[model samples]
Target: MTTKTSQGRFFEDYRLGETIAHAIPRTLSGGERALYHALYPSRFALTSSDEFARACGLPAAPLDGLIAFHTVFGKSVPDISLNAVANLGYGEGHFRRSVHPGDTLRAESEVIGLRQNSNGKSGVVWVRTSGRNQRDEVVLDYVRWVMVRKGDFDAPAPPPHIPTLAATVKAADLRVPKGLDFSAYDFGQAGEPYRWGDYAVGEMIDHVDGVTIEEAEHMMATRLWQNTARVHFDATLRPDGKRLIYGGHVISIARALSFNGLANVQLIVGLNAGAHANPCFAGDTVTAWSEVLDKAETAVPGVGALRLRLVARKGGAPFRLRGEDGTYLPEVLLDLDYWALVPN
Candidate 1:
């Protein structure tokens, strides 16, 4: 009998410069938005109400940016990281356009970098993934690298080819949604009165809330995105027998927690860099903090951009990130840097 099952591509199978188009395009609807909001404490006015969005010059409320991101990332998992050890980091991420209900999204990725780990059992693969809509317009573009186990230990190592990525996405390159105007924004409705000018370059904010991770919710979120990474679903894959929480889950949670202090940050347009500093499991109470790294003005009237560092940790005093040796503390779960559009 012939085997029709795919065991998934291992590290030795990836070729630099090869492009893979992921399967099963997803068409999102209000159901996705509803479920996303139910899963996370998301309440940004622009995405929460059509009236609010129209008031800001948009036709209707758009899906949260992370909804598009997770959808795109999930589509690529089977082709890119089905046999992975871990999804390491992301850089140069840009949300090119707003994603709304009724749009069908698909993803394609190009392998740009490859490096074998010294252990010979695993290697890192970097790919630039682009998510496009049914119209073939790019919605999101980003680079992510993952460590994947090798199916065959004796396979010859591929020559390392790491692509140099931008350390930060220049403000000039950010794509503010067309017609996004906060000139007549309702400060009371947004949940916070803080405007872009209110934030200083070095200011820090403790989000002042914590949500204990629940296994059911994490599983639901991963399945909602169609993310089929074994580590996220199969406890037997890890030595500890714990299903690894999806990094994006932590990101969404952190972003939701940020609403307390950053309620007026209406939209996320750029992701400079991100790292899953440590593995997260169910039952860990996640908390977050943010630092105003920098700010910039956009051509869009009434819109400004804020460069922020959002950190999610299991527990510790706020503002503590890296340790004395310049490594993330064990309690730190996520270190994310991104740019958001705010009322100027």
Candidate 2:
């Protein structure tokens, strides 16, 4: 008898410096926009109206930043984290170009670092992945690390080669899209009067909105992104008999909730760091808040950058993050530091 089923790559199959060209190019469309709005409470004016986008000097409304992130992340799952224990963290992310409807996207990754866990049952693999459009232009680029299970626990561990990643993406490295002008931006139409100059560092805003996660919505979102992580869909995968929610799902909802406070924050240009501090499951009501970390002027005519720390939590006092020991509180689900573009 012959069996012909691939079980995906285990920790032993990975090597530093290996370049993987992920398969299955996806062409996005209006359907994605519709589904995203249905799944989350996204109401950013620029992404909601073509006319609003045009006034901001864009040809059309670009897909939500998280949609572009999920598409790129999904393509690398099979090659990178199909047999993963957990998707660990993200760092140094940037959107180089806006993704519009009808654009085809693909992904490629290069293994940059590796480390064997002390338990010897799993290892962490770090890869820098790039999502490119049909024009072969990179739309998104980021580095993420995942903890993957080892098919053979007895296999010799690979020498550790952890790369020194930057703690934050430099403001100068941020990509302001070509012809992106906010001089004519309308505050009323955009739903917020705050601009780059209006936000001061050290200020915190509690986005007082919450959304309870639903099983059906998460499944639909995972399928939409073509994400094949078993833990997100298979209840039997864990001993708890509950399906794990995708981290990106938490990110999108948190970002959507932030709109109430960060209404005029237009483009997500850089993701400096992020961590899924705790597991999020269905029925958990998620809320978010943001702290202005830093600010910088951009070379763009009317654009500026605001560095922020976006936090997602459940059932916690507002603005609380870490506990006494300097670790994230049990109620905290995500801690993301990023930079967004706004009109100066």
Candidate 3:
């Protein structure tokens, strides 16, 4: 008899420089967009209406950038994080192209670095994953590191290798969609009059809204993305006996809530860095706020970029991020820095 089953790749099983082609190629449709909007408070005009997108010069509305991201991230779960402790952090992420409905997407990952924990029970694995469309055009790419459990404690650890990553994706490197012109952008249709120039560096905006995570919705979102992480689905996987809400869920929720103050930020073009500062579980009420970190002009007429720090917290006052020890406070759930395109 032969055993044919996958227990997923443990820390000791990974080898640096190896590439893994993830399983399942997903073809997205407008239904995905509808479900995504239903799952969160997303209301970006460009993605919400075809007419608005056409008015902005795009042939049609593109799916939310995170939809591509989560799909790719989900495909990698079985091969990358099926036996993981936590998905730690992300860096050097860029949305190279707009993803539209009817496009089929797939993902592959290269193990870029590795480091074993002193505890001998777990280790970190870093990978650069690329999501591509049917035409082989890269849609999204990013580096992520996850802490994975070591199946065999006695297995010899590999020499540690950590990769250097960029602190931010430069404005020059951002890819503004072709034909995206905000010259005649309708502030009335967009639901906001604020433009790129209206925002100032160092200014903070409190979203002033909160959404409680429900067990059912979280489960649906994880399954929708094909994320098979045990901690997110199996109650017995954690000592607390509560399912962990997917971090992307928190990100989408925060981004949607930001519509209150950032209605004109129609596209997320670059992701500088992100961290799941703390674990989020069902029943947690998530709130968000944003601070303008920097701003730049794009070559596209009427388009500019804003570097923002979007922080999501379970509780506590806005603008308070780190503590005296230089670590995230207990209330902080996410600290994400990214660049978005807005009208000039």
Candidate 4:
């Protein structure tokens, strides 16, 4: 038998400025939409009803922003983070277009930075990835860094090159879907009465809901995205003998929880920053909260953008993100900052 299988690339294999076109383009459908809603407690009106979407000027109900994000992120996992210890952080992520069913999506990433850890066992690889639709239109762009294992301890460290990433995507640069007209947005249909002017900076909202993780659910969701990361699937990969949940899984659930108070906040346009504070395992009950970080008006009439800090926790008190020591608390699972479209 001719033996042929891929072992995946290690940290030593990456070179700065190298562009990788990830394999396996995916054509999305209503199946993914149904599975996503089944995996997470999602109930956004624009994505749930075609009438609601058209009322807001969209041709049809679009998939959740995170769905598109996870699909794109999943395409790079086998090549970028198959042996990753953890995905460290995300910055400068922007959703350029809304994806409806029947759209084909592909991903490409460029190695922007590399730094070997002093221990020589691992290194951090920073990459900027772009998700493009079949038309070659870029749907999303973001920067992420992950801690990847080094296959050879004796391999010399690559020259350190850390890319300077922007802290936030500028409001002006945020792409509002063409023909998006919220002037006719219906509050009753959308589920929340609060408009853009209602959210004041520094206000905190406890979503007041919790969902315990199920190993099967996370695995199913990860498979739905076609993510091939070993850490999320192989229980024996971790010393604890438990599979790790995908970080995007937590993000989707957290965003879903936010709908309790932010129901009318539709369309995530920008991801300023995010961090997975701790590893998530099955049976952990996750709750969430949100803070109004900032607000800005958009060129689109009757539309505004809100900068929000969404926090997911296992069992922490509401509104607590970090401890006095300026580090994320042990119970904190995720800290995500992003911009969403809301009625002005």
Lowest lDDT 10-residue stretch of candidate 1: 178-187
Stretches of model 2 off by over 4 angstroms after superposition:
none
The sequence of per-residue lDDT tens digits that candidate 2 reaches over residues 1-344 is 88898789899999999999999999999899999999999999888999999998899999988899999999999899888889889999999999999999999999999999999999999999999999999999999999999999999999999999999999999999888899899999999898888888999999999999999999999999999988898899899999999999999999999999899887899999999999999999999999999999989988999999999998888899998999999999999999998889
Residue lDDT tens for model 3, 192-297: 9999999999999999999999999999999999999999999999998988889999999999999999999999999999999999999999999999999999
TM-score of each: 0.99, 0.99, 0.99, 0.99
Worst 10 residues of 2 by lDDT: 191-200
lDDT of 4 by residue, 41-96 (tens): 99999898899899888899999989999999999999999999999999999999
Report, for every candidate in turn, its global Cα lDDT versus the true structure.
0.96, 0.94, 0.96, 0.95
**How many steric overlaps does candidate 4 have?**
0
Instruction: Write the residue-wise lDDT of candidate 1 on 1-344 in tens digits.
Output: 99999988999999999999999999999999999999999999999999999999999999999999999999999999999999999999999999999999999999999999999999999999999999999999999999999999999999999999999999999999989889889999888999999999999999999999999999999999999998899999999999999999999999999998999998999999999999999999999999999999999988999999999999999999999999999999999999999999
Full-model lDDT, candidate 1: 0.96
TM-score of 1: 0.99
Please report, as a residue range, the 10-residue window in candidate 3 with the lowest summed lDDT: 1-10
* Residue clash pairs of candidate 4: none
Q: How close to the true structure is residue 98 of candidate 3, measured as C-alpha lDDT?
A: 94
Between candidates 1 and 2, the one scoring higher on TM-score is: 1
Candidates ranked by lDDT, best first? 1, 3, 4, 2
Q: Cα deviation of 30 in candidate 1 (Å)?
A: 0.6
